[model samples]
Target: MRLETEMNMLQAKIQAGIVKDETVGNTSRFSDANPNLPHFQDDLDIWLTRSERFAESKNWSRDKWSSSLSALLTGRALDCYGRLSSEQAQDYDKVKQALMKRYD
Candidate 1:
């Protein structure tokens, strides 16, 4: 019984750690402003690459990635969201790929 209680306590600690990470990760890290419009594509691309590297399971859910990306975009960069097709908007991977294709 003591062993089981210890295991449960360990599991709670591990779960709590994951939640803390997810909370921190949800914040926007990319910047939307760059004087050179073309160069901004490189910035966005690099951000995406880094995001993938840090993503849980090395794979970010479509909604999670898209939400993060949207939070960071500004100006013309933000306008790209309007271009999403109905089908693409519904899928996170499709939204990510479409935005990358258009912006990066």
Candidate 2:
């Protein structure tokens, strides 16, 4: 009975995205600095919204929506980085690298 209980608990944790061997230490640093980091669904929503807005405003065909959204997001990212202070941007890059390494 005790063994069965432990197995059920382990399965529940794995289903909840908490794999025991996934990380050596806390993985909160990535989420801490960039609280708005895009998850899978968030990315999809961002692209969809951008495409919808572009098509509505410019009367663009559905086929052009993807290209328009890609350009807009790229421009927006560049603009945001351009507005950041050099030191702050560098620090952001370092944090980003650390986060990537954590996943790797």
lDDT per residue as tens, model 2, 20-47: 4456654332211211222222243454
Question: Count of backbone clashes for each model?
Answer: 1, 0
C-alpha RMSD between model 2 and the true structure: 18.2
- TM-score between model 2 and native: 0.24
Top candidate on lDDT is 1
All candidates: CA RMSD (Å) = 15.5, 18.2
Tens digits of lDDT, candidate 1, 38-67:
212446667656554545443545445444
lDDT agreement with native, every candidate: 0.45, 0.36
Mark the regions of model 1 whose C-alpha exceeds 4 Å error after superposition: 1-42, 57-62, 85-87
Q: lDDT score, residue 100, model 2?
A: 31
Quote the positional error of residue 89 for candidate 2 in Å: 30
